[model samples]
Target: MSTLFPALALTLFTPLFGGLVLGLVRPMRLAGWLNLAFCALSFGASLLLARDLLAAPGGVYTGHGLHIDAFNLPLIVLTSFVGLTTAIFSRRYMLEMYAHGRVTPLRMQVYHAMFQGFLLTMLVALGTDNLGILWVAVEGATLATVLLVSLYRTPESVEAAWKYFILCGVGIALALFGTVLVYFAAQQAIGDPEQGLTWSVLHAHADGMSAPVMAIAFVFLLVGYGTKVGLAPMHFWLPDAHSEGPTPVSAMLSGLLLNIALYAVVRFKMLADSALGQSATPQLAGHLMMGLGLLSFLVAALSLQRQRDIKRMFSYSSVEHMGLATFAFGIGGPLATFAALLHLLVHSLTKSAVFVTVGHAAHIAGSQRIERIRGLIRTQPAVGWALLLGVAAIAGFPPFGIFASEFLMLNATLQSWPWLAGLLLIGLAIAFAGLFRNLQPMVYGSAPEGQVAVRANLWPVVVHLLLVAWLGLAIPPLLAGWLQQATRLIAGGGF
Candidate 1:
């Protein structure tokens, strides 16, 4: 475990260094290459961490600031992979923006810098075993993303950035309060400030801590991090941010950032559940998750039917998926946890692939409005088919990764909460209908007047969809084993 320290360091600091370098670099072309180089390095480092995980004992910590366990490593790997793929897609997307004269060289430099910084904060948040540091890292990611969302400098972009900033800022503040409460609970037992705030310390002593305090702390944590996860009633900022930001940023927000926020919540949930044990308080927290998850899923599924913006439609899809994943985790069994893990993996891959194709489609049609963009199959077959494949995967079509996870979730939910299982089925059906309704007109008809298709980098989209397809058909032994480990860790750690 100690041997993996350097890989972890590389994984954490590469982005910080890249962001600093990119911010000073003048040439846009050089900056793009540097971004990809750094992302690739980080991805490689994460793979090394995976290798170490396979060989090592339980979780390891290089001190308390950085730690790796089955629970967080899957997320760490997914983030690095998405970071690399997004870099590849964005190279051309941003170049096209340059061609359109919508972005100056300085803007390009800032984009690259903020992009690295965003990745850095997520890595920090995921790697940390300290609640206070995790909060700081999440806040950093939020601030960095606000810069990315506002990069276009349009009125809509600026408004969306402000909305993200304000909403997530409040959410972060609430999360801080929750953290303090947990630490306070720990202090009552451990009687040491430094030890009280440590994750492993809290977990080891959790069952002895105040159950009522754990319950209240989890409420604040769930609402706080749920806000960042784009759960309904706190989700107004998500669609606007996705619609107005660069397509690459939209992809990360839905695919990466939301997951990172949920990662934080998962850690807190595990702690809270451990502290409360079989007390009704733990079950109450789980019920809160189910209730919120069910509400978000149903609301976002219904809301998707009304979106005119193509990006907004997919943004809502993200919300629905996050809600479903949360509900699965809330159920807290090995099967449900495995399903949640699979859903998170597939959703990240598929949603980002969809956005990559959408980025190109919007470029082709000169608009992101669903009513305005048409004939993608005719005008740009690659982009059209990528979108088709992605949409199918997201809609939970059979032989797709999402179907497998949803199937597992339903199967598990039935054994415990049959009524909630029925509700899950309804929400999935509604979301599917909403997606398919808008999908038909966009992919089948003639192009709107004055729109022209353009070439795109489709490799990233193709690779992601193929991976999702593979997962749906057959999850590899290695991947399956890893996910199983994660499921065991989350299930046992929580209760």
Candidate 2:
């Protein structure tokens, strides 16, 4: 076996194997610890794989039906790292839920099991070289998350789960049709029935594929995967799903899952743009992405002003950040694409940390309602301060990773489309103001009596924010190189 095989095996299968064992094992005062251990191992493996790929010539991992490159190595690393931190945070959160009788032993087992399975699905989606396999993995993720979302079995939770299922199911079906259309275009262009819809194969011949066919296929794809990305008009299912799910799941949704969906869109967008290069289809796909992305960003920014539920508010924030990232990618150049890539890492780390604080605050406040939760500076200082830090980081404050990425995006926009850059600034300013307006009162308002937080597991919160802080101050050269290479690959094609 290649040296890559072992690390890839560990990175890909450990979570599924752990999930199987976790499901079978009895919950021993809860085995959340086990989940943490598994995620740690997978994170280590992914890190190793990334390091090796970087050291490897061409920064590629080919063969074995897997295609790991500059583009996906960062994403895989991000997913694994976030999975570990979320696992660490959940160990504390779920144990508390069990103690309070909000979760039973069996449900805890299921949660741990499904959490690992969810990780497995994303790794699969990220790793697979084939579009069909990618679609399968994404669909698998939907199933895994639905169980996690409804783990509480509350009527509302179940309703949210059902809604997520129905919307994503329709979306997935459309994606399948899009995939078939891609294969049809590929088959016609490549004249190879055996090769199927492997991305490497499709990419090599994207220019030769039918423009009209590629154009229409991309529209379906943008809508199909864009729904899961929570772009507005297709975003109705997202807030409810985030609100009703466990906080850990909410973190995963915003930090990891949404990124994966957007990654899919990015993949298809690249393929669509390449396939129709220099034709009447000129920038049509890019225009579609920018249109939807701007719509989502502006609408979600306004929607955030109305949120009373903390999770729902942050969920909208996820939409806003995702839209911004999408818009950057849709703009499509070295700086813009690099900004989008960096934003994925920054947003995932920061938003997840924010959710950890949100989870802590909800428990401490005895409610997820913003009106009911007051005086975080008084009632629970640690949770309150952590929440403040997280909120500020997420709001793109100075000296944060988001700030760096957003600045790069604006600089890129001004150089190209100064008018759209104005819209981007307006959207971002509105979002920033809306988040502060809601969070200010919650953080600085009068303290509610009779509520207290448990001494929280602040480690994950500290670690994640610190990492984002580091990125903001200065992204390490190696990481910057990786982001730049990935951006170039998206813009100028394969390295």
Most accurate candidate by lDDT = 1
lDDT of 2 by residue, 1-495 (tens): 346768887998999998998998786454788898999999999988987787788887776778888888899999999999999889878888877888788888889899999999999899888888899999999999998999888898999999999999899889889999999999887877766688887888888888888888888888888889999999999999998899999999989999999988888888899888878767988889888988999999999989989899999999999999999898887888998999999999999999988998888887899888888878878887888889889989988899999999899889888998888888888888888887887888888767665668888889999999999999999998898788878888422
Candidate 2 backbone collisions, by pair: none
- Model 2: how far is 5 from its true place, Å? 2.2
Residue-wise lDDT of candidate 1 within 100-134, one digit each (tens)?
99888988999999999999999999999888899
RMSD, every candidate, angstroms: 1.6, 1.5
- What are the lDDT scores of the predictions, listed in order? 0.89, 0.88
Score residue 231 of candidate 2 by CA lDDT. Answer: 93
Candidate 2 regions with alpha-carbon error over 4 angstroms: 493-495
Candidate 1 wrong stretches, greater than 4 Å: 59-64, 493-495
Per-model TM-score on C-alpha atoms: 0.97, 0.98
